[model samples]
Target: MPRIACLHTFDSNAAVFEEALRATGLAGVSLQHTVRADLLAAAEREGRLTSDIAEETVAVLRGLSAQADAVLLTCSTLGPAAEAAAPDSPVPVLRVDAALAAEAVKAGGRVVVLCAVETTVEPTRHLFEAAARATGAAVSVEVVPQAWAAFKAGDPERYRELVARAAGAAKAAGATRVALAQASMAGAAALLPETERPLTSPTVGLAAAVAASRG
Candidate 1:
């Protein structure tokens, strides 16, 4: 069994991400609330990540990887830090969006990165571009930054609606596929069943990636 150590910034994402792993038929999941929200908050406020903050996230990863075969980082804000830490980790440390980015590039030319948070937008776009480069795909990114408010207000219905509207806008902008940047946005993706464009979720991507890593 591949014991996945899921590192999360918010407690809210734990249940949803664990359920995603279960849906993938991999039950060996350990969720950890890395109380490093301050680093993310600072990163969001500064519009860039500093080494000290990234190191804080890496420190959390180091402490959690002792008994696990893989680590899944569910927060996009910490993605760059996760990637930076992977080289020194004892096991594979994966950003949840890794699979989603690869899938988006494989499926479409114009990839729209739909993010609820401002800080996550650039990291996600960079990941998609990296994936696109690997696939030799010419891709352009369109970012939609309008769902974080509903999320912060603790309104699920409005949150989903905002995300759904962003999805519609991405399709209208000629996006071949859309990738939700946050785990919280997965609920929004669920509510968008009638969406004409292909949408990707980190929850689904992370589960699939961890399952494959076990093989």
Candidate 2:
């Protein structure tokens, strides 16, 4: 079995990947998780990803790379660092939102990226915009602070409810495709209707990571 090491910014995200792995039915794939909540806390405090923070994330990935077939960074805010470290790592370092962005842009229309955390908004917007550049898809990012607050307050049901509402509003406003920018927000996608369900990082990202590991 190919082993994919997952780097997460939240302890809850470990379960997100676990559920995603099971849902994908990638039974042959194995996962190793490393959660460093401080990385995200630091970024949130700084209001942006700092050079030092990126370096710290890279150091973690470098260590994980030695033991796993691939490393997957499951935080959208730290995605750029994963892209930066990919070239130097022994194994592929995949950003969780990258595959989701690609898939959203593939729809070739107005795509809205919904982020619960403020720090994730810009990185996710840029990611989807870059993915849409060649495809002519329009990309927009919206940050749902209330949902983030709910999540931080340990009210997960309220958090998912808020996220789902925001997604529905985006769709009603003419978003042809919607992408939830964080792995933690993946549960909200389930609350949406099957036809309007938004693209989320965990399922797509894990599948992409596993594929990269095999290759």
Candidate 3:
């Protein structure tokens, strides 16, 4: 069994990814959660990530790494910090969004990345574009600020509603595919109308990352 450490945002709990892993029959793997309100709050304030926050996040991952075979940072805004933490880790470290971005580029070119948080959007866009470039695909990314607000306000129903609304706009914006940038937006994909468009979520990405790292 692989030991996996999941670093999450202050607003979320490990239950989100725990359910995803359970569904995958990967329950044998040890899963741990690390939550830091300060780091998450810092990201929310700056509308972008800072190296200091990245360093502080690394401290959390480092602690978890001591007991796990791999680490997965569940927050999209912390992707850069996650990447920075990897080289120092004893095991592999995966940014939750990177795997989804890779999958999105593989699934479609005109991809739309939707994030609930303002700080998460640009970082997610950068990761998606980098992944698309690697796949030789072109992408168009957009940030939906309102989506994050709904989720942060402790309303999952409103969050899903906003996600569907944003997905519709993404479709109109020439996005043949949509990638929900945060783990909180996972099931929101189901809200989209049936069409040629495909919706991607971080749940699958996190699962894949854990599997790969464990292997």
The lDDT for every candidate, in the order shown, is: 0.72, 0.92, 0.76
- Candidate 2: list runs displaced more than 4 Å: none
Candidate 2 lDDT by residue in tens digits, 140-186: 89997699999999999999999999999999989999889989998
Q: Is candidate 1 or candidate 3 better by TM-score?
A: 3
For model 3, residues 138-185, the per-residue Cα lDDT tens digits are 776666657767777788888887877888877787776777888877
55-167 per-residue lDDT for model 1 (tens digits)? 88888887767777777777887888778878888887888888777777885467777777877877887887888986665555544555677677788788878887788
Best of the candidates, lDDT: 2
- The CA-based lDDT of model 1 is what? 0.72
Worst 10-residue lDDT window, candidate 2: 120-129
Better of 1 and 2 by TM-score: 2
Q: For all candidates, what are the clash counts? A: 0, 0, 1
Off by over 4 Å in 1: 27-35, 136-145, 194-198, 212-215
RMSD of 3: 2.1
Per-model TM-score versus the true fold? 0.87, 0.98, 0.89
